[model samples]
Target: MKRYLFIMSLIALLGACAKKEGKFDRADGTAAITVASLENHLKILASDAFMGRMPFTEGEQKTIAYLQEQFKNLGLESGNGSSYLQEVPMVEITTTAAPVMEVKSAKKKFTLEGLKDYVIWTQRTDPTTEVKDTELVFAGFGIVAPEYNWNDYEGLDVKDKVVVVLVNDPGFGAEDVSLFKGNTMTYYGRWTYKFEEAARQGARGILIIHDDVPAGYGFWVVQNSWNASKLYLDTRGKDLYFSAFTGWVSQPAAKKLFEEAGIDWASTVSAARKPGFKAVPMKLSITTSLVVKAKYDKSHNVIGKITGAKQPDEYIIYSTHWDHLGIGKPDEKGDTIYNGALDNASGTAGMLELIKAFKNMENKPNRTVVFLAVTAEEQGLYGSEYYAQNPVYPREKTVANINMDGINPYGRMKDIVVVGIGQSDLEDYLDAEAKAVGRYTSPEPNPVAGYYFRSDHFNFAKVGIPALYTNTGIDHHEKGADYGKQLQDEYVSKYYHKPSDEYDTSRWNLEGAAEDLQLLFNVGKKLAFETSWPQWKKGSEFKSTREQYMPKVN
Candidate 1:
């Protein structure tokens, strides 16, 4: 009897060890995320059949169906209560401006040519929007920051007038760090905010003077939107309404207007940059009318989920915007499709690859992991904004967010660049994962460009969710930063936002992309099993909101 008992006990112990080892085995799962798998998904998604993946079109239907099918095949539960799609209702605003908009002054008058000297559009859905002989007010930077003690529109009445403002904040060219986050753009510096503030001030319209140094991109970038339509989330019932017109005028055109008003352009600009600068009237009247056509439609944000075994309420979200610029004008080679192979198709494929990695793991997550592919990102982050505003899961229960906008097609890197550095503890998690694989973390080269506010991740960050956006480090593995820069410049000049953005096997190598996806997977994996909720770092604009709202979540 004693011998039999001993043998039985030994067998039980061995069985327990085997089960534990199997559950903890992490090797095969990590290997599942591979270059070939990512490439396959990327190539298929970027194919011509996808039609550039525009929202509210046949392409959107096909793209969403493909995502849903992939999730179903992987056995992922629907993230939106038995449905993978979250409908994002949006409005399309198509504005057509007259050829010549006249500018008038007491002394003399001149006409501004549309699409050349100025470009204007209307946000209102009304059939006709007018800016008829509205007086122009030079509101400096158009900022009203109580914290910075700056108010350009203080004691000014801009009603029924056009507010002409500079593109960037006053501190953009300042040498003093004390001046409004000096040289680094504050939220007030954004063009979107300019329109928002103008509406609040009861202005009829707002025109931003375009300067390449302050705007980051060149004027040609602005010129591309001469008469293009725009997509925006529908807020018809909201009390806040947008101004009738929002526009941009070239630097030379603005200077000519200043001259016509007898205001010294150089001295006026200098005074605007200093503190205590008040609004200056251009005394110039402008008249323009925009024929507006509006339509309402719905786009979908696709979501897939892996429910947790232990704590289903806690979650980690991975985000990617799946939409890109659809078919448009033909390029020199007659290619009309703006196949955004690198912009986001590559990143979306990486998210799908992550799903495979998580599914392959023997151990189920302790906290749920969510894969979210949002839409209408090319039209301005509307999809992610909708999700963030109306989250499927409570934001408090969410642990962290990892966002992939573009994966590096250049080979492996020695470092991964972090955008919006020092925003959260997510950086620590990424640093750990990168170091384990003998890579390092570095800050982005242009932190002042406000890249953190550009991608879908910004929507998550805006709602106090601790989020991280990373770029492939410019420091290449074999070559130096110069080589990496040359490649990026090529992408910008040759393919960025152009019909020639289609994938070419000769140009791209997915080894780096695969490695990037793996790193993100590890970060998500760590958060999946962990119990601690990551906090936004102190001094972050979003930290206070996180602390205030966390306890209120059910």
Candidate 2:
């Protein structure tokens, strides 16, 4: 009997030592993040049969059902108690704007063609959204950040007026790195923020002057979105405020507005960038109307989780938006459904790969791992916003958020791009894992583009969570950086937000995506086992928000 007891104790010791989570496997598929696994998932998710995976349609029904089935098959517990679906109340608004938007200055008058010179949309459920000769105020960047000592609407009463704002923040082209995030764009710079601030300041309407370089994408992206039906979180009971019209104007149209006001375009641009710049009324008014048709519905955010072996209450999250632009205006090839293959299908696939990687491990994590596939990212991140506002897990106990937006379809990269690099300590975890595999971390080249605040991860970041969002590196291992840049540029110009964004096996090689996923999996793997919590960096905008919930010991 004593001999038997000793043998059992010896066997238990060996098993415990063998289950070390610090192996830090360097090989790509060693952690189950293989190229084959990614391709197989992407093929089905990006297939036309999914009908572009739009919310409130058959596509959403099929997509969510598939994810739920996959979750059950993978042996993951339903993240929401006893169910994977978290119902999101939504309202779809389709706005039809008048073709010609008449602009009248005190001295002169002009008319700009809609869908070309400008595009307008409304979020209100009201049948008619009309702005009749609303005064235009050029609120420089339309920011009201007390930290930067900047408030463009300070001396100006823009109530019931249309505020025309620049697309980016002040530090976009500034020589000084001290100015608001320097060249890196902040939350203040986002067009969504501009509209929000305008509404907060009692403005009835607002128009953003769209410049291609600062706006990231071309005017066609705006035209594509506003011209189509839009989805917003249903806030019927709450007193929600939206401008009469949230719109964008072409550069030429904005220049014409300034010229008509006798406000020198060059001088206004110069003054806008300065620290003490104030709001200027263009002495012009915009006249346009929108016929709005809104309908209420429910969308589901499919969620799954692997409970922790030790600290079950503490959680780490992996997120992706499982949605794209659905059937819309046909392209030249007569394709109406926007596949969104590279935009998000790849990302959703990658998130699944991470979950599989975690599930395959013999040694379960110390903290819980939550896998969230959200809805309606293309319609302005409503799904994630819903989750952030109504999380299944407590925000204080949730450790970090690792988000995948789009994975690299090109082959292996020499480095990985870290968007919003200095925001959190989560990047440090990623850097360590990336270095283990002999690759390097690179900061995003276009910091002023504001890629950080554009995606679902931004929703998590907004509420004090330290979120990590990385992209495929530009420096290709075999092909040069120029070649990588060319491929990316082509996709942005040709396929981004278009029906042509289908999964092309001919153009895509998931080797790079596999490596990137392996790295991300390793980061989450480390976080899951360790007790250390990743925090927002000292100077990060989210740092204070985080500190409110998680105070530092020191």
Candidate 3:
């Protein structure tokens, strides 16, 4: 009887040990993801069937449907007031193509061919708007940045005149690295800011010169993007301001215009760098007209939330833009759909995988996890901006926002590139999580492009929430950092903003992407349990805003 009892006791002890080991093992905790999962998700998201996930089209419908289905499968709750769809009111303005832009000058009249030398668009809601013989004015960089102590529009009334400006800031060409982050494009250097400032100055039109390096991408990118069907959030209800016309001039076209005005283009650019430079009257006038059809449409932001077991009110948000450049003018091979496989399909899929990982966790997070797949990121971060302005949850209660824009297809690496590295304490969390996985965190390789302010996270950051956006590092397992950088450069030159950016399982290494996602998950997981609120880094533009906006705990 004693021997029989001993055998039963030993069997029970061994069974308990096996169960404990199975629970602790990473493989047991979650199923190992197959490359097939990533490929399958990308195939559908970037498929020609989805029409490139454009915001205001049937494609938007199909894309949102697929996302909703996925969220349902994951058992996540609807994030938008008992529904998964968040209504985003938008207006679609399609401008009839203009044939030619005539610039009349004192010495000669030059006609700029549309699409060949320049591309122009209008922000006005009117059916027809004309800029008839508007006077031309050189408005320096067309920037009015107080932070940099630079105001290009100072002491100048550019009203009712066409403002011609440099592509980047004054400190760009200067030898001093300390001057305006030399060579790096500041927020003032962004074309969006330039156009907005022009409108605020009451200019009739704004024209920006295009350069490859300072602008990050080549002139062809700008041409292609502007030529595509443009989408903008409906500001009809709001008192938004814009000039009569907004456009870009090719380098050659700009040179001819300046030469016709008897102004040396190179010398004027140099002179603008000096202190207290006045606007140069070009003695020229620009004439153009736009015919528009305004249609009100609605876009949806896909949101799903996993409620916290304890602190359900406090939240951590994970976001990625789901929209891309939709069907447009055919490419060389007659491919109209901009697949955007790498531009964002990869990031979208990563967010889905993150949802899976979070759901698999044994202990539910203390803070609710909100998975937000926003729309119209390509259209100047409009979806995120709308969400920030009208949040389902209070912005103060939201602990942090982690954004994924473009995920690296090339496998695992030794480091991660934090877009806004020094702006918040979020980097410290990411650094520690990365170190645990044998990786480190670094700043963006090309900071001058102002990548920090480019992605969806910037919208949350602007509203005083600590936001994080990181990309795959340059270092590669088989090829090292140089080769990884070369790959990135090749993509920028060849595939970026092109229809050729489709998915290929053979070339992609999702191992690196999975690792990055795991690290991101860890960061959120740690924060979800912490009792202390994460603060923005000192001296950051957002720090003071947080102090003013967020409720004090003391």
Top model number, lDDT: 2
TM-score of 1: 0.89
Cα lDDT tens digits for candidate 3, 418-508:
8866779999999988887678988878777788889899889878999999987888878877677788888888888789889877777
lDDT of 2 by residue, 165-260 (tens): 998888777867678777788888888899899998888988899999877789998887666877899988887788888889999989988889
The ten-residue window of minimal lDDT in model 1 covers: 19-28
Write the number of the candidate with greater TM-score, choosing between 2 and 3: 2
Model 1: how far residue 512 lies from native, Å: 1.6
Off by over 4 Å in 1: 1-28, 104-110, 146-149, 155-157, 177-180, 538-541, 544-548, 551-554
lDDT of 2 at 450: 83
Compute the lDDT for candidate 3: 0.82
lDDT of 1 by residue, 1-554 (tens): 99999999999988755543423233546898988889898998888899899898788898999999998998889999989999998999998888888888997778999988888888898899887888999999898876577888899998998999998887787876567667777667889878889998989999999999989988887898788889989888877668888989999999999999989999998898888888888889988899988999999999989988778998899999999888878899988888899988989999999999999886777788999999999899999999998899989888888999989988888888898787799999999889988888888777678888889988888788999999977879889765666777788799888877777788898888788778889888888877778888765656766887887423
| Estimated TM-score for each candidate | 0.89, 0.88, 0.84
Which is better, 2 or 3, measured by lDDT? 2
